[model samples]
Every structure is written in structure tokens, then in C-alpha cells.
Target: MEEMLTEAACRLGVRGAQVAVLVGGELREAATGIANAELGTPMDARTLMQIGSTTKLHTAVLVMSLVDEGLLDLDEPVVRHLPELRLSDQAATASVTARHLLSMTSGIDNGFYDDPADYLATLSRMEMLFAPGDGYSYSNASTVVSGALVARLTGLSWDEALRRRVFEPLGLRDCTTLWDELPYHRVAVGHAPDGSVVRPWTFSRASGPAGSTLCSTAGDLARFGELFVRGGAGVLSAEACAAMHVPQVSLPTRRFAREWCLGPYRRDFGGTAVFGHSGTNYGGSSTLLWAPSTGVVVGVVCNTPHAGYPLAAEVAAEVLGAAPYDVEPVTRLTADAEPYVGRYAACDLRYEVSAVDGVLTVTLEEVASGRVSPPVALLPLERDRFLPERDLSGGRGWDLAFVVRQGRAVRLVSGGFAARRMA
Candidate 1:
């Protein structure tokens, strides 16, 4: 395991990595490389690394606990708990429910706000990408709202609720929603692609519920994963636990993921059903995968962005005796893509489509950063449906589907978000 970890870290040019694998009711851990590249600190089992969006799982469990206690309803409109909830779309603001937030189908525009209050305030000024629960769009604001709901219903802060409800019950002593809350010495420093250190180790507190902040050791995360395998042993009812694993929305274009459940992303690994979550912050990446049939849970953390996926994949293959199933190949069709060539905008994201030498290509731009990603060639899968040659960031499947109206592309849908064509 250590050899595999070392190889993966080296291959990805990561400074360090830590992994925990649970099998046959026994937990095994391995660590390799430096926790702090400058200080030459070694990463170990106790090293705390940011788990990123994986924190969503913890938040989901907290909500489930409330549901178990009859304090919350999954289908209740969020405004019922926080009547002040306001959005640019008043109807969506009133109609959005807890179930939509948990399932990432709220259709609220995604943004990173400094605090939960700020998120809600900004949401109130933004229009919905789609009607509430009309489509799947991963929104950090939605999770922040969910966390706020938890706070309101439990009479506790999101952090406090997590501590009292999740960390304490699951015995995750080394986990925390805030970076500063962790002991400085035990925390693993994050590093950029160039190996430079990243400051402000955590995202803003407002993003905590949506997976912006949460630092924990691999071992601590494995213990949390065990809860799912054990069917909610102490914290959640079996029914609630089952609900967390059940598929809530289909995500066909996502690489390995088949659906988004209450919290975790669901996928199939070598014919065995596996559910888990992956998280990435500025300079670090982490993943937690568990298969109930085999009782195997794998948790991996790396101090470099995008390094955890390959490492976690290797670990999963070793434990499951087979790799993740291959993504279905997109069948290219013979169709003219000229009508689809145009610029599309949605919230902070922009899409530029063009055709050159009879080949169609698409590039996504971040409006705020003015950063345009490299153009990816799009192959026609149907008249208006296409698939990117490669996967987009955020595990969004390579599939790109267009909504055409009056012989012009109206919207480009991919990565669970829709970008309307700019006139």
C-alpha cells in the first residue's frame, strides 16, 4: 500500500499523501512523502488534511439525524424553517425544499460567498438557472442554505451541530469543519501545482455545509465511512442511512458517477455498488469511497490539487480486485454543428463554441477570473447532443447536450448546469 501511495504521489507530482483502507472489519493506513515540502515534515496517519466537499456527507448525516429525531422533513420547503430565505426568483425561493438542496437539484446559481448570510443575500439577487428541482446544478449556496437550516432547526451553529451530532457520535476526534480549529502541528499544508504553499488553508465558513471547509485525517474519515457500511450504526436510522445511498438524480454525463444521492455520489465499481464523495480545495484533494458488499472503505488525501483521484482509483482497484467500469463511448454522428457555434453565458460561467476545419470545439471561461480553459473538441452524438473528448473539472461527464430552438442552439447543458446562448 505504501509503495502504491508513493508511486501515485510521485506520478502526480504531489508532495505527500495519506490513505486508509477498511477491509474485513480491519482498517489499514499508509502515508508517504512530505506533509510540508519546505519543512520536510512527514505525513502520517494523524496528519489532518482538508477533505473539501466530502464535508457534504457529514452535513447530510447531520440533517438525517434531525430527520430521525422528527425535527426536520426532507420535503419541507426551506423557507418554512427560515422564512427570510429570499432569492431573485421569488417562486423558486418559495418552492425550493430541503430535498432539492440535499440532492443538488436546487438549480441555484453556484458561487462562493464569504459567509452563509452573504450567500443567501447574493442568492436573493441572482436568478435561477432552472426552476427549483427542475434540473441538477451543484450549488455551494444550496448547501450553505441547508446548513443554515440545520442551525435554525437545531438552535446551533453548523459547526456546533456537526460536532455534537456527527463527529462526536462517529468518534471522529481528528475531524473539524474549520481549519484553524485543528492543531497547527497536525495539519497538513496544501501545495499548488508548482509545489508552492497555499495560504488560508480553508475556504470561507459560509461554504462549510457545501464542502468548502473540513479538515480531517484519513483514519478519522474511514471511521465516518464505516457508518455507511454498518448501516448507520449509532448516528442514523437504517432507513435514513438507506436514503443517503439511494440515487436521487441521474447524472449520466458524469465520468464514473451514476447519480447524486442525499450526500455522496453513487457509482458502480466492478459490478459492486459503491457510494462516496470527493473534494478538492485550492491546493489539496481528498476522496472517500466505500462498498457495502465488500465492506471496504477507502479514504485518501493529498496535498496537491487533482492528485487524489488517481491515487484513490489505484487504491480502489487494489481493494476491489478490479478497476472502475469504463465510461460508455460516445457514438459520433454525421451532423453539421455550425448552428451550435456561439457564445453562451450563465451566472459566472461562459461558454464559447466554434467550428474550425469542419470540427467543433468548445471552451469554458470563468467570467470573474477571465481565465479560458483549453478548447475541447466536441463529437456529435446526435443532432444536437455531443460529448467532449475529455472530462471537465468537477467530475462532470464528457457528455454535452444542447437544447435547440428555431434552428439555433438555445442552451448548452453539461456538468449539470445550463448556459443559455447569448444573443
Candidate 2:
């Protein structure tokens, strides 16, 4: 396992990497490369590496634990708990529920924030991309708000609440919400594509609940994954555990399974059902995969941006004895494609749909940068749904699904956020 990880990291130009696998009730671990390139620190089992959004799983677990205690209800509105919660859309601010936040369907705009203390204020000033529960849009603000709700309900800071509810319970001594919080000397530093160091080594504390600021070793992550494979025994109720893994909303990407649960992305590999989450940060990527039937959990982390998935997938395939699935082919465009060709806007993004040469394509424009992504071909999936011929976000495939109203497309839903049609 160590050799495989080392080879994968070296081949991919990853500065540092770690792998931990749990099989047959035993935990096996391996590490290779440097933790800190300047200091020439070698990677090891105890080295702390940022897990990014995989921190969502821990936050979800904490929320579910509260649900188990009957102190919170998933269906309750966010405003019900945090009455001060407000968004640019008053209705959505009042209507959004905990479930919506957990399912990534809160419809709130995803904004750029740098301070943990500013999360609530940032959310208050943000506008809704769509109505709550209207569609799936992955928003960091939604998860950070969820963390704030947890803090309010527990009367503790988000970090302290996590420590009391999750870390201590799971005996995750090495896991922490921030890199600077790590007591250990061995910590992986992120490196950009050009091999330059990504300084600061951590995201703002405000984004900790959203995946910007959590750090852990591969072995610790594997142990966390193992709890799910075992049905959430000591941490969450069986029912709560099942709920977290069940598909709550359909995802827009083909790189992952079509559906996402409360925390992890759900998918089937080689007919084996798997649930886990992946994380990406400044110059690091991490993945945690678990197959219940095989009782196998695989965790992989790397200190280079977007380089962790291949290694993690390799480990998962080897453990489950499965090969990678082929990409879904594009289908013929339908006659009803006219209704879907239009302009849609959400937050700082604009989408223009058009048909040329009897083929349909969508162009995405970033409002701030005025930078337009290459027009991506859309393959018909259903009457109002289509899959991009290529993954829109590099290796992660994002699909397009139109929301129709009064027999005409009124919105474009993809990448977990809805874009309203602009007339």
C-alpha cells in the first residue's frame, strides 16, 4: 500500500501523500513524500493534512447527534433556531430548513468569505440563487450557517461543539478544525501546480464547517469512515446514519454518482454501493471511500491540488475488485430542445444556451471575471435533462437539468444551484 501511494504521488507530481485502508477489522496505513518541503519533513501516519470539504461529514454527524438527542429537528426552519438568520431573499431566509442546508439545496448564493466571524453577516447580505428546496446548489455559506446553528443550539463555538460531539466521541485525537490547532509537528503544506508553496496553510476559521479548514491524518479519516460502514453505532442512531447515507438530492456531476446524501456523495462501483466525500483546497485534495458490503474503507490525501482522486480510486478498485466504469455516451438531441435554449442567471454566474448545427450547447460566464467557459455540448438525458459531453469542472462532470414552469423552461439547475431564466 505504501509503495502504491508513493508511486502514485511521484507519478502525479504530488509533494506529499498518505493512504489508510481498513479491511477485515484491521487498519493498515502507509505514507510517502514530504510533509513540509522546506524543512524536508517526511510524511507519516501522524502527519496532519487538510481534508477540505470532507469536514462536512463531521459537521453532519454532529447535527445528526443533536437530532438523536431530540434537541433539534432536521425539518425545522433555520430561522426557527437562529432567528437572526437573514438573507437577501426574505422568504428563503425564513423558509430554508436544516434539511435544506444539509442536502445542499438551501438555494443561498455561494459567496467568497475569509473570516469565520463574518459568516453570519456574509449570509445575511447574500441573495438567493433560487427558492429553498427548489433545487440543489452546493453552497459553502449553507454549511457554514449549519455550523452556526449547531453552535447556537449547543451554546458553544463551532470548533468547541465539534470537539465535544464528534472528535472526542470518536477518539479522533489528531483531527482538528484548523491546521494551526494541530499540536503535532508533522503537518503537510500545500503546493500549487507550479510546485510553489501555498502559504498560510489553512482557510479562514469561518469556513471550517464548510471544508475549508479541517485537518487530519489518513488513518484518522479511515476510522471516521469505518463508523459509517458499521452503521453509526456509537456516534449516531442507526436510523440517523441511514438517513445521512440515503440520496437526498440528485447531483449535477457525472464524476460522482447522480445523487448526494446529507453529507457524502453516494455511488455504485462494480455493483458495490459506496458512500464517502472528497475534499479540495488551495493545493491539496482528499477522498474517503467506504463500501459496506465489503467492509472496506479507503482514505487518501495529497499535498497537490486535484491529485488525490486517482490514488483513492485505485485503492478502492483494488479493495473492491472492481474496474472503473465507462463514461456515459451522449444521446441524440431531442426536438423539444428549443424551450431549453435561453439565458439564465444565478448570483454571479450567467448561462447562455443555444443550438448550432443541430447540436445544443451551454456557455457559462463568470460575472466578476467576465470570463466565459468554453461552450460545452449537452447530451440529451431526458425531456428536460442533459449531460455535458465533458466534465465542466475539469475531472468532475456537471450535468444540466432545466426546471419548467407553465410548459416552458424557467430555470437551469446544475452544479447544485439553480439559475433563473432571464427574459
Provide the overall lDDT of each model, using Cα atoms, as 2-decimal numbers.
Answer: 0.79, 0.79
lDDT of 1 at 289: 90
Candidate 2 residue-wise lDDT, 1-423, digit = tens: 788777877887788888889987699999898877778888888888888878888888888888988989899887988888879888888789888888888888766646646678777665677789877777778888889888988899888898887788788877777455766546788877666788876657778888887888888899888889777858888888888888888765444556778888777787778888887777468889888778899888888765666666776777668844645546656666778889988767899999886678989898878999898888876557777876665444546778777787877877455677886
> Could you tell me every candidate's TM-score relative to the true structure?
0.91, 0.89
- lDDT tens per residue, model 1, 1-423: 889888878987788888899876688999888888878888888888888878888888888888999998898788988888898888888889888988888877776445544666777766676787766667777888889889999999899999988888877888787655766538788887778788876657678887777888888888899999988978999999999988888763455466899988888777888899887776468889998887888898888765667667777788777766643435433257767899987788889998887678889898778998999888765456666877665432446767666888767777556676785
Worst 10 residues of 1 by lDDT: 326-335
Best by TM-score: 1
Q: State the RMSD for candidate 2.
A: 2.7
Give the TM-score comparing model 2 with the true structure, all chains together.
Answer: 0.89
